[model samples]
Target: MKTNNNGKKSFVQRSLDWIEKVGNKLPHPVVIFIILSIITILVSEWVYRAGVSVEFFDAKANETTTINAISLFNSEGLYYIFQSAVSNFTGFAPMGTVLVTMLGVGVAEWSGLIGSALTKLILKVPNSLLTMVIVFAGIISNIASDAGYVVVVPLGAIMFAGARRHPIAGLAAAFAGVSGGFSANLMFGPTDALLSGITNVALNSSGNPYEVSINGNWYFLIVSTFVLTIVGTLITEKVVEPHLGAYHGDFNEHEASELSLKEEKGLKNAGIALLLSLVVAFLLMNPWFGPFQTIDPETGQKTLQPFMNSGLLFMVFLLFAVPGYVFGKTTGKIKDSNDFVESMIEAMRSMAGFIVMAFFASQLIAYFSHSNLGIILASKGADFLQNQNISGIPLILAFIIFSAFINLFIGSASAKWAILAPIFVPMFIAINLSPEMTQMAYRVADSSTNIISPLMNYFAMILVFMQRYDKKSGIGTLISTMLPYSIAFLIFWSVLLIIWYALNIPLGPGAPVQVSMIQPLIGLM
Candidate 1:
């Protein structure tokens, strides 16, 4: 019995060590993107010289068109490269969303509103449901962009410590939800818009243009949110927390205190401010008298189209900014205009690393698109799958596994989707599947691997958080801690998707699992 236990422990340690060593050996994410861009250019030139091309079935135009690779080494390519560099960085989808949203979030964090509120809320919850609440909060934090990583993840560790549980277990559970369950949110967020936009681009490129709603995967994601919460809770309570054993380290039990008079007042004032903002948003988004309402030209019916299209970001900005500003004033955190400006500046400062990464990522995406490599590969890959006659569940499972594997290398969700959607969306559509379903599958796969992937943008940050408790914590420690959640999520989430497919459920509003096949149309090469 002792030998068996020792053998199991040794095997687990060896596996974690291997993962950490390989992950640490990889180049920095920015360097990887730069190298990928250069390789794409070289590959494009080679493929162009070799006259390698593929014909895609265009259902709309009723004819097949050949797509050939374009080399980026030519004069025109050089001109495009030089001309589009600045625009690429500025126009990167995640860049604007993260920056704009953080302006509001920075104010909240700087004012101490977020921390106080989180402490109060978590402290009041029953211990039995504490893990579930933390996981749920982490999942929902996506609606506010990346604030969860900086706030909820650390808070989870602190809260768990206060509760006398292992901090690392709490950290793992929170990280599982924040990064691994990123796509499973109760509400549509900037991620939905970002990925949907890319999916639309892919659909259009495939000669089967269609508009995808922000709620493209609403039903599935809503269900996924609960599933992840339950799975995360069970894993933490049964597997992770128990494995960590008791807390022998020093942790401040008094870290989470009951709300003080000033803090309570600030929260009340902030709540009022938030309520008022919501009221105004409701009025503005109302179809009856709201200026933001629109009348469809064809239907001659009033609709909240304008608000639905752009109001989410504006609402998020206001939801955080108004409450934060109110709390700051109430708590004397904001003394003057200078303080407010400084808060926003600090927020932007925190995102400097992401911005740097986005610059390289944007260039890589642009190069790949210009070179037509993604489309070509997607086409060939789709053709190969078709040749094998692997349609339906097996194909989707294969794609999910492939995507999970890819996540180990690429960290950015939007960046990966931007590249894959062009190929997969069209290919799936050709096989009588909806783009929405394909996007959902990608989300499932992308999220399932995020906890284990060191390439994730927040992985290093999470390691730093963990090391606060375990001084010896490193890449291996974090990976070994999070590996179970990663494996469980991938297996269970993939199974859920399979079950969803079997039911032929609608993925979102007007988005079904399958689409009726139409005759192929002519496509542009």
Candidate 2:
């Protein structure tokens, strides 16, 4: 029997040990993706043979659409397998974002700009407040796709090491906010646009005049940003850090050192370049004569929608590349344009393994989507809830739970909502619930489990980050370290949600809990 007695392993430790041993025994991530791809191919054929199909509302087409499992085990499937190989790798969205972002980030990192910044941050921010700030920054970082995992998570470790704290704990905190707190953010992003569009399609299919705004959950998310920051900090300090004990690794001592005169000069120039770049970006986006500016057809006012939509990615690349180049030149780390190019190449070298993993993962994801199994399972879950006689808070709670369960399997928030929204949005409308609330609930579920799900696109990248700090760190270690933050965030975030529901607060501008039940009461009133 396991006990807490001296020399006897406690139950939790034993459990973690078992998990680590078992997980480490599993296949490598690339091999695992290959295996899942095979499984998806075989299952598609089986399900198709079994005649499994689903009929659901098509919000986009404004009609009922039927889905059936398409067998990837057939001759046609073999052709697709061969034909789409390169396109699947190239078209995989996350793969492109990471690869491109790394080109600039790698240069910045290799130029010693990122390291010097971490040292400055360590000196400025209080150690007591460091974890909270990192976690908060992580949540905010999601505005730039993949920035949190690819940037903040590693920076957290470096900053923590500079502060003489446990680097793993710092990594855990950043991961918690970037992923586990993904549902909570102060601003709208691609996720907001994607999910809202899906939600609106569902609402359109329901024939409801009510439309969910992209900022529908804005206020709640604003609160969540702060709430999650506190909760994440508390969990990291109280649970994750104590469990990690102390970091005893041979870390880069230069990370904590005071920057030399040249280094400080480089940082200063980099900062100015970054700020000036932002000002130029604002002018290009906001001025009436600016190329990116557009006049609203209805309001006849200039808007930056074009820039916000199309320019953000380029902006992210410049944000890193421009400052990095200036810093490199200032510090003489980059003697020529070739030195700059070499730094970028070095960054790509680090990502060599991840790029391989992305290739296999793309194939697996493409196969899964082509097979229609993900949507089928999601629909089956929605159908189960619809058949239940549940309503009000209980139904909402049940949906939350089910969506969270669905999240364990499906990693894309937009994909999950595309299936869920068509069913739940209208059904909730008939019962006095708003589409905004439905969308909000789905967001909560979508984000709560991201850290623990191996299928999360960035999970492999984060695991690589973990190994850099702790050679013994495995999938199990990353999961276990993050599991507490996930649980705590799920619990408290849900509680905050419940409290918000009970108070009948406005979810955002013109978004309410009951949606006024206007359509239902129209004739009667």
Candidate 3:
């Protein structure tokens, strides 16, 4: 009996250690993706009913195109799987957008402008205000792609350590801001543009006439930025820091303060240069006779209703290009123009891995769409869900829960939106609820789960990082660390949205919280 009891205690201790250490340390994102992929494939079939057709068009012509009656996976036999996979991976993937955006974004990062500017600016704030600023910076860093992961996270850890707080707490706080605040930002970005384009596609397919502008979700996102900052700071100070105890780890103070006076000066000059560049770009883009202007002269009618939409990609290019060159020149990082080109080249090279992953992911999505599986499932699922008779606050609450759960498996906000938009957007539109509300709800769900989902590519990287700090942290450690923010954000953000919806606030320019369903407004091509 004594021996058994001893053994039982030993086993229990091991189990607890595993849960606290090894299990939590295990890479989460890849594991989650594999599991979700399996489930998605298992629960869904490629085939739908015969004679069903979805109309679309080929890119080559103005003529109409149609997605025919049956699943290619079934009708075309075994070989179709490979073909479908190739099509999915190669065509209509979000990878290109990521690549194109990164090309411009990477230049800013590689040139040291992003890091230098953030460090100098953030460090100048009083220590009391610095933490919040750092968190806010992390949230805004999403616009620069990898800058948050590469610069902010480590910089944050170091910043907290300098102030004699637990470094891991700082790291966690920064990571939370960067990933947790992914969906909310002050500025419109490439992701916004891409997602909006896809949203328009989904809406137009359902016979809606007007274009859904990129800034459609901007109003709510602006509010979310403040909410994320407050929540992030509160979580860091209250939950994460206390849980982390004190900083006992080995840290080099000098390493944390490596920025030289030259770099600081360079950063200031770069800022001025960036401002000048923006001025030039605005002057060029906005001029009635400038080559950059898209409007027609004869009619005096504007070609681009949302100027931001037409100039977004170019704005991205200028955002990076001028800052990068200015920083490189002032800091002697670029001795000449050749150096600037080389910096851009190196930035593109870094995305090789992302491009590869995107290839596979794209294939999966494309093939799924090509198979007509998404439409079939969407139509059936929406039909059933619409008939469920859930309404008002309860239905909205249910929508939140549903979106949150789905978010755990699918990490890409836009990709998940693309899939869910077709289903939920139409359903909400069919009812009295608006697509803007549904989209906003989806964004809330998508952002909240990012911290917890192991399927998030970065989630695994974060686990590896935690293990470096404490060999015993694992899935539970990560989840537990972030769970507070997740819960708080969900409740508070949802309440905020509910209030917004009830007040009938416009989500963006002309984007109503609710649309009249009794007499649907139709637009002609």
**lDDT (CA) per prediction:** 0.76, 0.82, 0.64
Who is ahead in lDDT, 1 or 2? 2
lDDT for residue 318 in candidate 2, whole number 0-100? 83
Clashes (backbone N, CA, C under 3 Å), per candidate, total 10, 0, 12
Q: 1-525, model 2: which lDDT tens digit per residue?
A: 223448676565566556667776767767878988998899999999999998887655556779988999999888889899999989876676677778888888888898898888888888999999999999998876666677788878878888888888888899999998887888877677678888887776655777788888899999999999999999988767766766778666635777899999999999999999998987776676777878878559886665655556667778888999999999999999899999999988878777787888788878888888887888888898988998988988899889988887777887788778888887887788888888888888788889988767787778777877786777778787888888888888888887888899988888887765545422100
Best by lDDT: 2
Sort the candidates on lDDT, descending order. 2, 1, 3
Worst lDDT window (10 residues) for model 3?
55-64
TM-score for each candidate, following the candidate numbering: 0.72, 0.91, 0.64
Assess candidate 2 and give its lDDT: 0.82
Ordered list by TM-score, greatest first:
2, 1, 3
Candidate 2, residue 95: how far the Cα is off, in Å: 2.0
Summarize candidate 3's per-residue lDDT along 1-525 as a digit string, tens digits: 012344453443343334446545554433543454444443334234345654432212223445454443354633565655666555532344444555666667677776665555545656677679778988898775545654567567756766566767777778888888887899867667667766666666556664567788889889988988998898788666766656666655412345788787887887898889878876766656645656657447654434443345556666777777777888888888777778768866765544554444444444444455544443344445646888876777777876776666555576556655655665677667777787788778777777887555566445545654565656677777777677777888888889999899998888888886633533211
Global lDDT of model 3: 0.64
- The regions of model 1 sitting more than 4 angstroms off are 1-13, 57-66, 138-222, 234-254, 295-311, 390-396, 402-487, 500-525
1 versus 2: better TM-score goes to: 2
For residue 134, model 3's alpha carbon misses the true position, in angstroms, by 4.0
